[model samples]
Each structure stands twice: as structure tokens, then as C-alpha cells.
Target: MTPYKSKKSFKTRLVIAISIVNLAVILAITYLTYRWNAQQLQEQTIAQTQQTIEQAGTNVSTYMDELYRLTLTPYYNDEVLSQLEYSPTNSRDKLNSKRVVEGFLSSVMTLPRSEILRVYIANDDSLYSYTRTPNDMPDLATYAESSWYNEAKETTKPLFIEPHMERVYGEKPTTVFSVVRQLRSKNDNSKTIGVVKVDADYSGISKICNKINLNAGGLLLIVNSQNQVLYRSAPIPSGLEDAMADGNKIGQSGTITLNGQKYLVNVLSLSNYSINIVALHSYRTLMAPLRSNLMKSIALAIFCIMLADIGFYIIIQKFTQQLFEIVALMHHVEDGDLTVKAHVTTNDEIGYLAESFNQMTEALQNVIDRNAQLAKEIYQAQYLAKEAQYNSLCSQIRPHFLYNTLNTISLLIKCEEYDTAIRAIESFSAFLGGVMNVSKDISLQKELDICQAYLKLVQLRYQDRLQYDISVSAELYSEQIPSLTIQPLIENAIKYACEQNRGQTVIHIVSCVSQDRYSIQVSDNGPGIKPETLESLQQRISTPSHDETEPAHVGNIGLVNIAKRLRLKYGNSASLDILSSDSGTTVSISLPFTKNEVTQ
Candidate 1:
């Protein structure tokens, strides 16, 4: 009953934990998705606004091109040019010229274009005027002093001037933008005769801006080179003019806060005129859809979490039903009721678990029935595990050395060192003969002889690059240890040393006896193993293999295999250790010296 209560509590806590995690994950996903979509909508709105500004700028440029072409009408007419150049000696001649020039200007204005409010030709002495509306024109002296006249006088190119109130006109002062160009004498192109001016109201600019739809609370403005607003689609926002000025200088898109409302601003320059098209979109209005989407996402997350919580409850209940039955069986078994078995009801994981539980209880009953036989069987299994480990290590050691020795002999024969090659073959044959003694135990003297023969073949291959020394007390020569154990360690030392450096590598094998433990130390003066590699090797060797059916070891697993064989043969009384530094590495094997025989 206590176990059942604990499992029920655990199941309840697990369900709560899973539900909380699911809710947190779903809410986070909802928020992140909303943020991503909002960012995308912002970028898209900005791009669209910029594109519309570009289109409006193009339209305004085309309109200004037409107005500039109107200013060139005097150059196309011979009479107009003669009138412009005429320096009349009397008022009658002046009046005649004025009549002709004004008539020509009047004809130019009659082209069904309402945007052109007036046209004027002026010189230092006189001013001629034509207008759709009968408004007063500035005198020649007043026109000469104006900014447009001075700018036109300096450059032959038409100058598009900023807007200013035409206070001289009748009824009320009208706001007008004008294009002016200096007229030069046809006979002498460098000599200035007069200047022509064409004034336009905001109608054409308004038409271009109106063609673009900037949603609600959006603004479009046309500003002259002086940052003066020439046309506006809606009411102007404060600080927008300053932003436009900075934007024109830098020529980039940005966002600004205007009157406590965020606005995305984009500026497009009119290439044909010294003007810019500034478009402003309300950030709140543009992101309205994103707000809507965020609400939907949050609602969906709530629904999903609620649905997931219900589903988790159902699943936990279904899974824990079988789990509770297994728990009850476990309780019975804990009380020594081995006959209790969990009924298997389905072919799922729960069913398999129930079946395994039944098998476990039956096995427990069987183990109780045959305690003596089970102990004997366990002993035999341990012996087999040790024997299997030994044979696996021996097999790995035998094949690789043969390949190295044979390859060395082949290289020597190819060099025509027939005597040395024959001696290497003799050493190889002796080494193989000694290695074939598959007994699990071998005398230390016999192991030393095999190592000596192996080293001779290695010497024949490396020549002066290799050197070795073996020192053992004569009394300890007959000490029995695991076969192929010391030889593989020596091989590992020589193999690492010669492979890493061209300089001479020294291998020293010495035996020491202290009290009851005999130790063999193999030292190498090769480039030592890296700290990480040495640590990994130590970890691999120290862990005992529990599975006998594991695949045959490969690579440098030979070191690990030898360590395992030693552990199996002598149990905890034996150990293999590796010590290394930048200078060198040493491998030590320690075995208890009780007759030098392994545990049964």
C-alpha cells in the first residue's frame, strides 16, 4: 500500500511537470512567432512605402520635364528670340515687342494645362506677362532682384526654385513653384538678352501624390531643394521636416516619432528636378495586422496547451494503470511472494514490461530452488569470461606483429641485404613460435625471450633508430604471468616511439619486487602521449568489459585488452598504470607474488 501511494504521487507529479513544460513551450513559441511575423510585416511595409515614393518621384519628374520644355518655347520661335534680343530705342518699338512676346507666351499657356498659372519674360528695362488668371506681375526691376531671376541669370539650365508667396498677385497671395531659364542672343550665344519664367501651382504635384494610396494616417510630401514643402497630401507632422532634411543629406530610409506617433519615413529624389518625395506611414497602422495575428497566436497557444494537458492526462492514466499492477506485484515479491505475476494484456511496451515482470518472478523462484547449482554455474561463467578475455587479447597481439615483421623482412630483401633479411626471418620465426604457446600463463623469462626476438626484428627494420634493454632478476625469471601481457606493452612503447620521431628512441624494461608484489616497468623516451590521449587510455583500460560477445577489439584497443586480461587473471590484486610527461612515458604492471599464479 505504501509503494502504491508513492507511485500514485510520482505519477501525479510527473503529469503536472509535463503539463507545465508544455504550457511554457507553447507560450514561448507563440511569442517568438508573433515577434517574427511583426518584424516581417514591418520590413514589408517599409519596402512598399519606399517603392511608392519612387513611383511618385518618377511621376513628378515627368511633370517637371514637361514644365521645363514649356520654358524652351522662346528658343523654338524666331520672332520670340528677336523680341527677347530687341533693345528698342522708343516706347512704340518696345510696345510692339511686348505685344508680340506676350502673345507668344499667351499661346503657350492655352494648352489645356491648369497647373501653369502664369509665364513672364523680363529684362533689366521691361517685363512682359501672360497668365490664365488675370494677376499682377512683378516689374523688371523687382523680378531681377528675386532669387529665381538671379539663379536663372547665372546658369543656362532651367532652375526649379522653391515655393514662395506671390504677394504681388491680385485678390490673395498664391503659393507657386517656378522654373526659370536665361535667354541668350541667338546671334551671340554667350550674350544674355532676358530670362523666361514659368510658374506652377501645386496641382500637378498633388495629382502625382494622390495616385499613391498610403492607407490611413499616411502622409506624402514634395519638398524642394531647400527642404521647403511644395505639396502635402495631408496635415504636416511636427519634426518631419527636420527628418526629411537629414534623410535627404544621408539618402537613407528610417523611422521617426512625430507628435508621439511612430512613422516610417522614406525619401525618393526626383532626378529631373531638385526635389524629393517624402512618404510617411504610421507604424501603428502598418502593424495593425501583426497585433491581430499576435492575438490569434496567443489564443491558439492556449487552445493547444489545454488540449495537450487533457491528452497527457489520458495517456498518463492509461500508462500508469499497467504500471500500478506491476508495482503491486513488486510489493508482493518484496515480501517473498515469488508466485505473484503481472498479467500481460497488450502487445505494447507495457505488455512487454508485464511479461518481463512475470519472467523475473519465475526466475527468482528458480534461483531459490537451486542455490548450490547457481553458485557453481556462476563460478564457471567467471572462469570462461577470463579465458575469453585472454584469448581475445592474444589474437589481437599475434596478427599485427607478424605483418610488421614480414613487411620489414620484405623491405630488407628488396634492398638486397640478404643476410640481414635472413636473420630477421629467423627472429620472426622464433617470435612466432614463442607467441603460439597459447597457455594462459607464461614464465617471465620466456616472455622476455619473445620480446627480445621481437625487438631484434624491430631493430633490423629501424636500424640505428631503435634500441632496447631488458633487466630482470634471475630469481624472478620463472615468475608466471598472463601470456602476451608484457610483450604487447613493450610493442606499444616501441611502436609509439619510432612512429613519432626520427631521433633514437630507447625502450627499457625492468622488473622490481617489493614485499609481495612483483612489478614490471616499461619506459620509452619517445614523444610522450598528449594528456588528453593518456587520460582516455587510462579510462578505457580501467573499465572492465562485462560482455564476452563484444566484437574483436581494433586500433590501440590492444592496450585496453591487456589491462583487462591482467585484471581478470589476478582480480583486484593486479593493476596496470601509465605515467607520462613531455619527456617520456612509462607503463607499469603490478601483480601479487604469491607463487606468481592467478586465482582459480
Candidate 2:
């Protein structure tokens, strides 16, 4: 009952443990997939936003390129450039030069731009000038010392001046971004001729920038090479402006806080113009679509997991149900239900196991039925054998032994050898007492004493012809053996060697430890048995074999009987071994040996 409960408890815990481990694995995989997909979505969104910004930057660069080309046309005109160096000698020539310069300027002015506020050419001598606003030209010497002239003097390329209000009028005026170019003499490249400057209306710049934005609340601004903001959809935030001024090459799409709202700041460098575009996109606005998609995906994955978990639970429950049925069958078998059969549900390992168990149970029930039929006969046979063995142990010493010893005492008493007679009597008494005890086994020392007493009695009968020696080590004193086990071998030696032979018969008894076994040996120096007899006797001594027709010996037991008792007491671990040759015969008794006491 206790074992069945424990097994059921273990099965339940094992199922729970497997389920928990599987659930943990599923959760970990889901979390990793979610994180990886989210990261990929974020990277793709940022790249797409940057691509749009670059496209807008290209459009702004094209607008700047058009302005550069428009400023270059007047510088390349030879007619307008020639008048800058023409010095008129009289009134008619001066008027003729003015008429020629005015016509050329009028043609330039008629070319397509409505936003060109004015185009002017001026020199130190005031040789010629063209302007949209009358009296707009400044004094040449003082203007040459200004920042725009100094900057233009340094480069032959067209330079776009930063947007500023025209200061020629005393009051504040229209804002303009101007292109300044220094005119060179047509013949001598180094000659100081005049400077042509075109100012663009502010509305044209507003057209280029105002139409572009990255996202809602996103700031779009264009900065010159010096990092000053020239045009913007919104004012540049201070943090971004400072980063730009410091010339730090910040990476695209990083978080920045603007007016307590997070924005992703990105910059685009225009290759065709001396400007960089900074765009600040609101982070939340940019991620809104991706967030919606991610939520949908997560919800779908969770729904799938829920369905899978339900299926897994049902499968595990069915699996445990099959196991429980097998366990119930085992419990019946434990309670001695050899007729019980386990029901097979599935063709898995558990099902195969249940099938094998059912087959074993049926086979076991059949064997039990067969064994019950033979029980009485076997018991009767075993009882008769045990009774024979008991009687044999009780009378191991022959009646002739007692008769001869009593006759030896009579001879000793007549010879007045009292001490020898009394010693013989005492030895006989001890040997008789040991044989009377019902214990089938005795210690090695006790068996040895009985053997010695039997030998001593035999010695008195043939005092000169019989010679014997006993050898034993003290360590084997407590080793157990069948009572009177060794005495029969010694008596057999005396009977065969002393009674049959003419020459002196010498017997040797020795005990020793060998190979984790206690061995007692009885040997004799006498004529050996015939070869055929020795082999036949060894077969019987190897295992106790009997024919039912054969009669028992009336006086004493034989070596085959002793072998039977040895097998009974110690199974195959104890033995009686016999060997014979021309010189002698040796009989050995081997028992399972250990230092610990063994009870029989």
C-alpha cells in the first residue's frame, strides 16, 4: 500500500515538472521572437524616414543650383563687362555707352524670373549700372570694404549672401538673399572692373523649405556651411543648434527632447549646396503605425499559444491516463492478481509494456496452477530425505567403533593401563555427546574433536599398523561445517587403507583456508582405488545421486550422503571433493568461508 501511494505521487510530480519546463521554454521563445521583430521594425522605420529626408534635400539642392546658374549668366556677358572699363571722353559717347549698357541690362532683366528683386553692376568710377530699384546702388569704395565685397574678392565662384534686409532705404525693408560675383576685365583676368550682385526675394526661399516636413511636429531647417540657420519651417531647438555649431557628426534618428516631447533628430548633407538639413521627427508619431502592427502580431501569437497550450494539456492528460491504467494493473499484480490483464490503449512503449505485463501475468498463473498439483508429492519426498539425513548425522560413528573401543579398554584395564583407558573413555564420551545433538552443523573445532576421537579409538584397535596425523590452523577454529562431516572421510580412509592393505596405513587430516573457503581434508598413504571405481565414486560424491531401488547401509553413512547434507546446508557454495591415484586417496570438505559466524 505504501509503495503504491509513493509511485502515484512520483508520477504526478514528474508530469507537473515536464509541463512546467515546456511552458518556460515556450515563453522564452516567444519573448525572443517579439524582441527581434520589434528591433527589425524599428530599424526599417528609421531607414525609410531618412530616405524621404534625403529626397527633400535633393530638391532643395536643385533650387540652389538654379540660383547659382542665374547669377553666373550676367558675369559671362562680354557686353555688360566691357562697359565697366569704358571711360567716356565726351557727352555723346557717354550717352552712347549708357544706351548700350541699358539695352543689355534690359534683356537680362526680361529673362524668366519674377522673384529676382534686382541685378546691379558697379565699379569705383561709376562707369555703368543697372538696377530694378532706382538709387539702390551703394557707394563703391565704402561697399568694397564691407563683408560681402571682402568675401566675394576672395573667390571667383558665385557666393550666396545670408538673408538680410536691404539697408539702402532708411526704414526697414524687404528681406533678401543675394548672390555676389566680382566682374573681371575681358582681356586681363586680374583687372578690377566691377561687381554684379543679384538679390532673390524672400518668398522664393520660403517656397523651397515650407512644403517639406518629416512628420507632425517635426522641425525642418537648412543651415549654411557656417551652421547658421538660413531658412526653416520652425526655429531650431537650442540643443540641436548647439550640436550643429560644435561640428559633431551626430548619427541619424536618435532621441532628443524638444519642448518636453521626445523627437528623433536626423541630418542630411546636401552635396550640390553649402548647407545641411536638420529634421526633427516626433518619436511617438513616427512609431504609431509600427506599434499598431506589433500589437496585432502579439495578440495573434498569444491566441495561437493559448490554443496550443490547450491541446498540450489534453495530450498530457491522455498520456497520464494511459500510465494510470498501467499503474492500476501493477497494483493488482502486487496484490497477487496473477490473473489480471492490463488494457492496452495506444501502440506506444507504454502499451507494449502493458501487453508484455499481461502475458507475464497469464504465464505466472499457469505456472502456479501446475506447481500446486505437484506440491504434496514433493513435500513427502523431501520429508523422507530429511529424515534419512537426520538419522545419518546421528549415527556417523559405526557401532563397530564403540565395540572396538570398549574391547581396547578391556585390554588396557587388564594390562593395568588406567590412564590410557580413562582417556579413551572420555574421548568416546565427548564424541558420542556431539553426535547426539540434533544440530546438523557444528564449528570446525568441534567437528575436528569428533574426528580426533574416532581416530583415537581406531588407533587403539590397530596400535602399530594405524598411523595418523591432524593439522589445522588456529584461525579456522570457528568456521562451521556439517556435524561429523570429516569423521566419515577419516573412517573411510581407515577402512580402505588399514583394513584392506598389508602394508602400514598412514592417515593425514588437515584443515586450511583457501580461496574464501574453509577446507578440511582426509588423506591416506595406501594403495589407491582402481581407476573405474574412482571415477564412478567421484560422480556420486560430486552430487548426491541415488537410485530408488538401492537400499541404505545398515551400520554407517557414506561420502555421497555427506555431500547431500552439504548441498542442503549451503547450496552450491559447499562441496565434497574426492581424488584418487596409485599413491593415495584424498577426500576434501569445502564450505563457504567468512570471518562472520554462519548459522545452520
Candidate 3:
């Protein structure tokens, strides 16, 4: 009996040692599996975020390239420059020259998505022809000695002017970007006849900057080579220009904080200009999922530890019996069953076996929780994919509208109202063409032309009630702008400024270039908009206040569209500021001066 008891004690010790070893093995496996799964999740998330950012950068670069082609190429070509050269010898000749220039301006403005504000020609010390009806034609003599003219004289390359406010266009100021091309006499290649200048409305660029699709709290900023902020969304912080200038480089990615939000920023440098495209995405928001996952993993580990401690002590009695039960529980856990528990009936080896069994069950529970989480992630991904498809479909609507409008113009031309038909056809052609080339970076002059064509159509439709004036310096025409920017503003002007008035309404358009930025102002001498309306205009917040019984002027589609487009194109660089009181309503746009050239 004594020998039998001794043998039983020895066996119990052996079983207890084996049970502890088994518990350690189970813990090790659980830790390894959890860590491996976490690492995979982290890697996948980082890769997806990086791909999304990279794709956005590529899209922006492609758009800028297209803009250059549509807007700047025509200004650089010899044929267009020669025709724009100043050449009037007398007053009568000057008038004829003005008509010719006007016709040229009309043609340029009609280019789809062109941003040209105006076209002007300067002969030796004289403003010869301009889109603006010159008041006692400004002495071009002094301008000849100016930096822009000197630059044009020296390089003979198209010059891009900086942003400035126009003194001649009244207090409602706008930005201008100029392109100056040297004109050589046809008879003598060495003889410099004059200079052809194209003024592009900077407002259009602002519009483009405002239209960029950005993540919540994300910003898009446009900075010229000189590091000046050409445009910014409202409430711009000081010193932003310095930051952009300091960090300008192609494909440079980094972190920045704006308005207390941390962002992952990427910069894309324009090929032809000294302009940089800065895109921002919120870093915190991007990493939220990872943080949540990590917390869940930690909680799972704690739950596993608690279960192992409690479950092991409650199940053991005899050594041999407990050994077999613990082994069976481990097998069940490995087979993905957390419900199986060890049934041991001894205080010695059986108790240890029970502890090992509990550890296995806890580890299995963690695996089950992880699987549930993965299932949730898959469902969320599917939902996001569906949302993306919906947004893509919505974006295609504008192009469809453009096609229908073009078709209508073609039909009208066939009806034979020759003069009106030609004008309508040209306007419609330009509008549709601009829409198709929406990705290009255009010159200010081209953008202005687009606006003019759009305004002409509006004027024709509204005839007696709508009239417009535009003033732009010849010095500010060649600057690069985003394509199809200005027409929307003009459309807004016609819709909101003239639609309600039986009396004649005058819409003033002006552009100027200063040192580092440019601005465009569109104002109307009609009943000013309400304060609430002006507030909504600048913030781009649209709240429908009009019922079916309300007048059409109460809610103008063009105005809302302009605001939406501006937000998308410029991101943070472009802004729409509306000021209205007893005085007329004015919409001002500002943008940076970038000397971006179009590639062939």
C-alpha cells in the first residue's frame, strides 16, 4: 500500500509540471497570433492611405498640365501674337484697330475654358488697342520703361505678371496675370514692332482653387514660385505664404498644422510655372481606425489573461484524470471551441491541468472576437465602395448638360438668325469646350474671354436689362490661371445681379496684378443682396430659402454653382468674398501669381 501511494505522488508531480508547460505554450501561441494579425492590419491600412494620397496628387498634376495646353499655347504661338500687335497710325486707324482687337478678343474668349480676361496691344509708347474702352488711352510711353516691358524686351519670352489691384477699374478690385509677347515686323525679322499683351482674370484661378475636392478639414493651397499665397480660403492664418515658400518641391510629403488640425501634406510642383500645389489630409482622422483597433487588441489580451486564471483552478482533482481532461480541452480550443472546459477532480496534478485548460479557452475567445471585427471591416469597405461610385456618377452631370447646350446652339444656327446665331454658336462652343478641358491650367486672358462669351450670351438673353463693363491692364494678361474659372462668376452676375431688375443693371468686371498675387472683382449696380445671402455666398453654405412662389432671383443656380466650383478648384487658394449693403453687391476673387507655361 505504501509503494502504491509513493508511485501515485510521483505521477502527480509529473502531470503538474506538464500542465504548467502546456499553459506557457498556449500563451505563446496567442501572443504570436495577435501580433501577426495586428501587423497585417497596420500594413494594409498604411498602404491604402498612401495609395489614396498618391492618386490625388497624380490627378491634380494631370489637371494642371491640361490647363496649360488649352490656355497658354495660343498666346505663345506667333500667328496669334502677330495679329495682336499694336499698329494704328491715326485716330480712325486706332478705332479700326480697336475693332480688330475686339474681334480677336472675342475669338480668344470663345475658346472652351479659356481664362483670358482681355487682349491689348501696345505700340512704341502708346496703348493702341484693348478690350477695355480706353479713357484717353493711357500713355504707354511710361509703361515701356516698366519692368514688365523691359522683361519682355530682354527675353522676348512671354512674361507672367504678379498680382495687383487695378486703379482704373474703381474701388472694386480684381487680380490680373499678364502675358506679353514681342511682335516682330513681318518685313524685317529683327525689327520689333510692338508687344501683344493678354490679361487673364485671376478670379478664374480662384474659382478653380476653390473647387478642389478635399477631405474634411483638408486644405489645398496654391503658392507661386516667389512663395506668395495667391489665394486662400477664408480666415487665412498669417505666415502661410512663408510656409509654402519654404516647402515648395514636387512630390514632397510632410506634416503641417492648420487651424489646430494636423495634416499630412503633399506638394506637386507645376511643370511650367513656379507654382506649387499643396494638398492636405487630416492625419488624426486617417489614423483613427488604427487607434481603435489597437485598443480592442489590448482589451482582448486582458480578457484572455483573466479567463485563464479563474478557469484553471476550478477544474482539477486527480493527476491522471486531470491530464487527459486538460489535453482534451486544448484540442477543443484549437478546433475553435471556447465552450469546452477541463473536468479534473484532484488538488494535485488535476488542479494544474484545469489552469492550462482555462488559458486555452481564453485564447480561443480572442480569436473569435478578432474574426467578428474583421467581418465588420469588410462590410464597411463595401459601403464605402458604393458611396464612391455614387459620387463619380454625380460628377458626370455637368458634362452632359454642356453637350445638350452645344446641340441647342447648333440647332439655332441652322434656323438662320445669322448674327445672333453666330454669337450664340460661338458662346455655346466656348462653354462646352471649356468644360471638356476642365483639367487644364489656363492663362488669365483666356479665362476672361470665356467670361466675356458667357456674359454675351447672358446679355443677349436679358437684352435691355443687363449691361457689363470690364477693365484690365495690358500689363497683367499672361499669368497662368485654372481653366473655366471666370464664366461661372459672369453667369452668377447675370443671374443674381440683373434677373430681378426691370431697370438697366450694370455689372463691372475688373482685374489687376500686384507683387505676388492677383485679384478679380465682379460687382453689380442693382439691389444689393441681403446680409444673410452675402454671408452664405462667402462661406459657400447653401440653404434653400426659396419656395416655388418665390421669384427666380431669390435663389440663383449660377451663383451656387460658381461657389461650389470655386471651392473645388482652388481648395484654399481661392476665395469668394461677397460684400453687400446700400451699395451694390461685389464678389472679389484673389489668387497667386504663377508663371506657368503651357506645354505643346
Best by lDDT: 1
- The C-alpha TM-scores of every prediction are 0.41, 0.37, 0.37
Error of 2 at 281 (Å): 1.0
Residue pairs in candidate 1 whose N, alpha carbon or C atoms collide under 3 angstroms: none
Q: CA lDDT of 25 in candidate 2?
A: 66
Determine the backbone clash count of candidate 2: 0
Residues 1-600, candidate 1, lDDT per residue (tens digit)?
575687557556655655666667777877788789878877877888888888777777788788888888788899878877867789899889988988888776534677777788888767888776545555444777888777888899988776666743345566687888898988999988888888777877887788899865578877766666777888776666665567544255798776688888788876456667877788888778777877887777655655565564676667667878898778889998999878787899989999999998898889887997888899999888767766776676667666766878899999999999988888888888888864768788788888888888889888888888998755566688877778887878877887787899889999898788889999998889999988888877787657633543565655777777777677788998999987888999988876542111
Global lDDT scores for all candidate models = 0.77, 0.68, 0.58
Give the least accurate 10-residue stretch of model 3, judged by summed lDDT.
544-553
lDDT for predicted candidate 2 compared with the true structure: 0.68
Candidate 3 ranges with C-alpha deviation above 4 Å: 1-86, 125-142, 162-176, 201-218, 231-265, 268-272, 295-600
The 10-residue segment of model 1 with minimum total lDDT is 591-600
Q: With candidate 1 superimposed using the best TM-score fit, by how many Å does residue 112's alpha carbon deviate from the native?
A: 3.4
RMSD of 2: 50.7
Cα distance off (Å), candidate 1, residue 181? 1.5
Top TM-score model: 1
Count of steric clashes across candidates, in order: 0, 0, 76
